[model samples]
Target: MSADTVAAPRLSLNVRYNRNVQENSGEEEESQVEILEDEEHHADLRPQRARPHTQNNPAANNRRCFKATAVALGGFYLLMLAGLFIRFTLLQTRYDQLSNNNSQLQDEVKKLKDRTEVFKSCPHGWTGFGHSWYFKSEEKKNWYDSRADCQQRGADLVVINNKEEQEFVSELSKDGESWIGLWYEWTQGGWKWEWVDGSLLTEKFWAAGLPHYNGYYAACCIQQGKWTQGYYSDNKNWICEKMII
Candidate 1:
């Protein structure tokens, strides 16, 4: 009985061992297939290395160049605008200075015109003729005293300039022998005729050979337009003349 039992159990155990080994090998193959599938998925998820761009892209290069050129041109334009602004400011300052100068000139011109207008007419107590005034003295005195009186009245003895002025004086002084501006005095260059204004006599209205005097100096008096010499102390009426203001 024992022999038969042991033999049957050993044969069953050997068959079970072979069947378990086959099952385990099938599970291991399935697990290996799953692990391979997982590796393939992970490789797909990893970032791929980018391929180098060996050939030049003309469109991209042109875009980069255009950007650089635009920046440079913008900077140049900005500098030009700044320069123009500075120049305009300088011009404006110069224009202002010119305008001020012109205004000052206009004001000066106006003042000159006003002064010209004010000097056009003569004052009172004087008779106007040409650009001067004349006064006839009412009192009689010596030649020296007559000249002094004329000076106190802001004038001097009358000085006849032309034939017309001599005629006028002759007509005005016909009443008496009046003291005239003509006189002869001894100088370094001998005796010569002079007027009260320090000018040498150029024109003469003398009664011929009547200006002769023996003294070192002498005065002249005018009865009419003709001139004659006399002593400086001789009494006479006098005429005065002054420039018109």
Candidate 2:
């Protein structure tokens, strides 16, 4: 054996070992790349998780709307009821006042009826008429004082009922103006003529352009078969009447 021949075999063995190591490393790299690609494909095919969501309830929303509408309607009805109550209260007060006035007038009529039972015929100086007695005053006085005089004599200012009575009273006062029972009074429809017994005038016998006085200070007077209005404070003659029983 020669030293050169031994060295050549050792070099050939080293070259074979290096080639095998490079081939093993290349195989390992290819295996690792295939494994990574498989893992990515499996991850893409996996199931997805669901997201959170919010829901709405239509019935609950309608109920809330209905409650709000009911509350508003109830408030409107309450306001109407309050207004009606106030109106009723005011009407009741007015009715009570009218009732009291009516009662007072009825008492006065009753007293006059009682007085009628006492006089059977016309008095000594009074003139006789249908179912009543009449008296004409000679002196002049205001309407209030004239009424006072008649009341003292158990009579009142004359209230002419019909055309005949109207004519008779007018003839009786042919001399000058005389106050009658008719006077302007306060009523629901404003000032109007009413008799002393609290009765409204039904028949009228006004003069030409007469009965035209204004305000509550007016009274009726007879002049030549016609009626006229004058101030209640005017000095004038008056007629009185007492009912016969």
Candidate 3:
């Protein structure tokens, strides 16, 4: 109705409209801020879901490491077992060789003992000359000269004490006459043997028919095997007997 009344009404209407627009704009901005905050929260929660699987990767890595370590330990144990097997094989081979050597040594000792027994059981004869049971001199000499040589060396002309000894000596003599200790004793009026140590002959071991003393020509001695007959003047091989000390 009046100008002032009209101006006051228009001002009131404008104030009411600005207030309403400010209130509505403030409400819309608050809603947009709430929505943005909710969206950020949801984004953070999505990453957390993936974080659980990412954390499990370290545990898987730890399990794989444990498996690798276990495999290494097993390999080491196998290597140790292989080394022990090799050592055992070597020791077994050495032991076998030593056992064989010991057996061989025992056999050799037994053979030596048997040979020694055979020598000890041999009959009383010239056993100290050489390895051979009987031996003949290489050179020839008369009976008296041969007896003198044998006597100087603590030996005597081979004397056959029994048939066993005669057979053994006869095989060693050459196919010729040899000098022995048998001789004719003019004072005794019988055939006598010039025994070692100047002892008289009590036991006689002659052939079937021997010591006839035909012209006192043949001079010989009884060896292990046979009667060796040689001329007194002729030089011939002789056998000497030596006692084993």
* RMSD (CA, Å), each prediction: 17.7, 16.0, 19.0
lDDT by residue (tens digit), candidate 3, 51-77: 986675787889999999999999999
Candidate 1 lDDT for residue 221:
35
Residue 13, model 1: Cα distance from true site in angstroms: 99
**lDDT of model 1, residue 22:** 74
**lDDT tens digits, residues 32-113, model 1?**
6766888887776553322235556889889999999999999999999999999999999999999999999999888666
By summed lDDT, the worst window of 10 consecutive residues in model 1 runs over 215-224
Clashing pairs in 2: none
* lDDT of every predicted structure (CA atoms): 0.73, 0.78, 0.64
Off by over 4 Å in 1: 1-125, 215-224
Lowest lDDT 10-residue stretch of candidate 3: 126-135
* Candidate 3 RMSD computed on C-alpha atoms after optimal superposition onto the true structure: 19.0
Number of clashes found in candidate 2: 0
**Candidate 2 Cα outliers beyond 4 Å, as residue runs:** 1-121, 216-224
Q: Is candidate 1 or candidate 3 better by TM-score?
A: 1
TM-score list, all predictions = 0.47, 0.48, 0.38
